[model samples]
Target: MTRHKLGFWILTALVVGNMVGSGIFMLPRSLSEAASPAGVILAWLATGLGVLMLALVFGSLAVRKPELSGGPQIYAKELFREGSHGSRLAGFMSTWGYWVGNIAGFVAVITTFASYLSTFFPVLTSDKVWVDTGILTLKAGNVLTFIVCSLLLWGTHAICMKGMNGAGRLNFIATATKVVGFALFIIIALFAFQKSNIGPFLAPRTNDSGETLSLLSQVNAAAVGTLWAFIGVESAMVFAARARRKQDIRRATIAGLLISIVLYVGISILTMGLLTQHQLMASQNPLVDGITAVIGPIGGKLLAALGLISLLGSTIGWVLLSAEVPFQAAKLGVFLPSFSKENGKGMPKTSLWISNAVGQVLLLSTISGSISAAFDFIIYIATLAYLVPYLIASLYHIKLIWTGETFTTRKERVTEGMIAGLAALYSLWVIIAGTADLKTFLLGIVLIVSGILFYPLLFKKGKVRGTSN
Candidate 1:
């Protein structure tokens, strides 16, 4: 049977939907807390260029190697090839890192979803309500939040199980809703913009004990905060196999990235202009808070509702992407074979369920913490996981350029090489920044090491097939 595939616009929406989720909703305050307004703008410009280069590299790979459709895993596997053991390890690690990142990302999505939902459903975000059953006690509000998150997770799984086309349509609607909602926000925010609120854009230095930071240092710090917003830029490449035209993958990736950048920078800048850095830092939901200050309480609620809808769409988009990575990798024997199994609708049933199961477990475990705390923990780890794949992919792109394997003209080659080099450097910087928190750094290391255990299973599978042959 012929399978239905996603077209250019739907693929673009997938990228946009996945990239614009929890990060943007919370990052305005985070960025303001980290740097001055000028520093924040510079950080966005730097991160934007870095991410755009990575996106372009992925798009170029889509065009140059259309048959390699599983994203980083395929890039590593093909570049390194079948005969090299180190190559196989690189391929497996790329796939594993991506899979881990997706699961962590999903947890962030659900936690953010519950957090926003709490604006309407107070119980989900309320302090833990203790319930005792003789010998045991449970946090009732936490348990309820867990149940809500689980239902959303599994419900999306069911939709995805039906087919990609159905999921894509749902994502398209969600993406459109969020984009329009944010556009309204930008328009309103601009009207509310106060010149004085920006306040000496570069921040003044006092002493070591003071809150002053150099512009360069501030930009560097802001880059780390903003990195999570762009985590799903590679979504189009991951689903390349399901694109109606291979060329659509390239177009969708670049277009989606540009759109996301504009929205991120515009909204964040306007948000800063509307609220003082001190006020923004104090705000739990900066966007909604800024809107409230301008329009009133009702406007805040409206934006909160819109934020929930946006997060819901993002969660759905990410679930599809998270499942696809391992499923596609398994098909190439880079992961356990079970992950490749699909239902009648051509969905990766086992992969989807397992990914959500992990996310569910993480969500339940973190229920004791505030939504912000849980989000911070999970997002940092997710950012760490994502950096591994990005770093490896950038390196592979550099290798291709060095080998003169990708471009036709000398100018194109030099330009592409420079871009790839800058992306590789950016990836390294982000990874270093992610590790600055020792606890998160150690936890990420442990997770990476744990993934190696599965390598033996793959090796065993290969040996059995060799004996059979």
Candidate 2:
């Protein structure tokens, strides 16, 4: 098992690949509805700085506490008093939220994949109904899309079950391909760029209800969508146990963040030069439209194919990540001990089944709506679940600095403090100000609070070691 460890590039690919998934392909349309060009710019800038700080904190902790193998769960749990209830609860709840968040990410990518596949088969998104009764109605297109998403989920699960090395190699190739593809599009968009398409850069965008949103409201509206693009920033830390070198985790994290930020900013902002806000907003696959405008119809087909490939690879990476959280947490005594089981190939068989099962349920929920609407709904819950762990990890980093636990160097202390401070503030800001709706936010809270029912299960068998978990 030790011989199959991941090197720096693969680790970096996980960070990059998981992040540059379906989010970027559909970003133009998502941002078009939420913000003007200026607001979009501000949202990315804020999210970039905030997530970078988080990457730094994760990297710093990897070096400072190599024993922390899992992501925020172990960090939040082990950083405090050993054998105490507080730390125990911290690890359990963090794992619960992050694990569920990972599942949401998996569903989001697969749903988008089906949406892009509609380029080849338009029926996938058609609202025409195939089956209906007085008691129930099922749109054939939605049913087909749901079937496509479920197949993708289980197919990716099968690949991961073979082991990480094979899945990682496939993901790395797809990541590289998408990066080149986006870079090519960015270059093409540059030559064909038009200032008028961008409209008034600072203009206030009107909401669908015919109400105009101010600049601040626009920024708030768009910030969460941008932040969602960078959701996999902690991929390296989550898989730290499989990383060949401790320092490589830090390098992979920072390198991945820089590359993804460039792609996200370029593809989103430059695409504005290719299509007007109204055109982009109406597009189901905005990148395809952007490319089609620049080069012709062939470009749309090529971009759609690329979107499928990108999301396919993203599914593999996120499945591995989501499964690992509970597997690692279980071994550390923070989750149910049964989750720690592994197959002959060193894959977490038990965790994979449970995680993907939850993902299946999420996919099933989308049958009542259009695939596009499902994407938005799933992303909201996923984003909200992800925010809590990020907040916990950031605050914990600051606490370590203040208490001089992670390191004692005074110069390093100030730098870490500043980074973690900004990260914590940004996490809080996104939750409080950038949320799309209050009901969805409360729904996420209910999901996290729901973990309490299972908390007592960990201690029933007395398997958790050295702490409260």
Candidate 3:
């Protein structure tokens, strides 16, 4: 039987769904905490341009390197496929880094989902428990929340296991719901706009010595926080193999990216206008809070419902991507062979199960405490982890341009070269911004270094295959 493939619209939904996750919902508050209104706007403008360039680079690669599927991993593998051990290690690192990042992202998504659900079902947000076993005391609320998260994770897994077409259709529904919901939010915010709320737009905070931070420093500080809103801009390129028309991958990526930019900028700017920086910083769910302050409690609850829908869709999209990356890598002999196994529908059964299992472990480990704190920690690390693939892909684009591998004309080469250069520099800037916290920086380094252990196993598998063949 032939497998049903994903089409242009579904692919587009995947990009939009993955890019507009829980980050956008809470990012207004997060950004407000770090920068002034003017600084936040500057940060968005900068991040928007940089992420757009990266999206275009991915689109260019999809068009030019149609044979190289499986996202950035294939780029690393093919670029270094000269049989040197160092080259092989580089390829494996790209794949491993991407897989690890997605797993961490999955944890962050589900945790956010649980947190949003807590708005309605306060039990999920409760910290106290009836039982107190010394070794493994379980909070009733947390256990129930975990059950709900696990169900959503595996339930989406079941849909994806049916086929790409089915999964993509489900994603389209979820994406459409959230898009409409966010549109309503933008409308309400605009109607409730207050000019006074947006004043002191460049309010730079003072240090302990009473020295205010410079405008440039304030904008720089907001870059990483705003960059989170554009994390999955390359979702379409990752599933290139499943796309019915390869060109659709490029169109879908650019289209989805433009849509996300509009939504993100609109929501952030409008929410800033609706509430003062103090109000935004104090609230956990700033979108909901802004709506509530403007209209009433009903408006806030509606926005909360919308957030839940948005996060659920986003989580589903990432889960599919998380499985696809490793499955494709395993087929190319980078990951373990088990990951290559697929069900009758051509879905990566083993990879899906493994990815969700890891997510489950992370969810259980982190959900024991404050959900918000856990989410904040996971998202910061996940964001850092993602920078690796973004940087590698940008460099790969530069390499292609230098080798004239994808350039058709002098003008094309120069334009792409400039875009790739800017993208690489922007990725570096975000990575540096993410590393401002020394402890988080060290943790990221440790995670990257830990990928080394899997190399020996991959080498042993290669030798066995060589002998068998």
Candidate 4:
């Protein structure tokens, strides 16, 4: 691949864009219903801490060896090269699992963009009165949804085909839109807040009604929801090779995470202040909806339209990032060689197509549902995909530090390693608690088994692509 001078800021922008997408715009209303307003705040705090730790872990590893590629794959290969074939297989499975998760995530984000678009144009969201079908029915919205999704998917595909520079420039713009949009939301909502809505805000509520016999358990569930909001925290880590400066990695990681936390907590407080619990819970797009209510119909629609742009920007970043995953893994010799190809412009041609294909499959599967449900399902899947790599990368850092590996001299190895190790542990806790569902658990298992089976076929070809230093 041709080396592009993609700076830390552009990379940071992608991280910001990916992290601040459809979730914050929509997840809060559902989260409010699941937990008390107080519980939601706690969730933000805990998830923020968890993400910070994970960032510290990756930061330490990046500092130690800037030569590594494929964030989790690099960590696994570095840690387990001395292990058996089965151990190696586990690493490969983990790498591919991460790829699957991100691809699913891309589809989810695009589907979400489609939903937000429907909000402004009801014609795009309305159901088809004519297609009275069986278990599966198509709507006019579905038609628009598919068309919009396909176009976005293909558009990103072409961008990736052009190379990292194109992707980076667009990511920068998207990231800026995201930051501005959130900031604008927070500022407007803060001044617009009514005193009545702000009172009794700490209404100690619960995340689930399944007899959570303890206060801590309830707190833990709220944390899980908050952690879900931070799902894209390590997004920039995957593109470690693309970072311009070594310190930039650490700086971007910390800055992006801190910004996301502030916005999350601030928005929550502002929204709660401006809207009654009843109003907030009742709203589908509470942040935007609240903004609209305050600003008027024109303002509401304008914010919603900005939201559509923000969502598209986010989806684009993820699609580019997701497309790079398998290609990165392939380059690192963790996946098949085909994924490692680059066009004349140094774009990961084959891998981009593969990512697009997977996203398309996910899009079609959920296209029949209401735009919201379809988008939610996609994001949920993407979150799981993101979690696996985070777990591996964090664990690898922890294992190295615990074992006292002498790979770095710039910082205290043991201190950094232990911090990273703990981050991994926290991430696992969050994943288990946050993604507790029969389907999600089953999907995780399926990804693991499938990766184990498929990687060996690629290995047998003896053309595996190794990582670029």
TM-score of candidate 2 versus the correct structure, residues matched by position? 0.96
Model 2 ranges with Cα > 4 A deviation: 2-4, 206-211
Segments in model 1 whose C-alpha atoms lie over 4 Å from true places: 1-4, 79-81, 131-140, 204-213, 461-469
Q: Give the per-residue Cα lDDT of candidate 2 at 325.
A: 92
Q: For model 1, what is the alpha-carbon lDDT of residue 68?
A: 64
Pairs with steric clashes in candidate 3: none
Could you give candidate 1's per-residue lDDT for residues 370-419 as a string of tens digits? 66677777877778888888877788788878888856788888998898
Decide which is better by lDDT, 2 or 4: 2
Per-residue lDDT for 58 in model 1? 87
lDDT of each residue in 356-410, candidate 3, tens digit only: 8888888885446666667667777777878887888888899988989857798
RMSD of 3: 2.8
Candidate 4 per-residue lDDT over residues 204-242, each given as its tens digit? 554334453234555555664566567666666777777
TM-score of each: 0.92, 0.96, 0.93, 0.91
Q: Which stretches of candidate 4 lie over 4 Å from their true place?
A: 82-84, 198-217, 406-411, 465-469
Estimate the Cα RMSD of every predicted model relative to the unseen true structure: 3.2, 1.8, 2.8, 2.7
Supply the TM-score for candidate 4: 0.91
Stretch of 10 with least lDDT, candidate 2: 460-469
Better of 2 and 3 by TM-score: 2
Q: TM-score: which candidate is best? A: 2
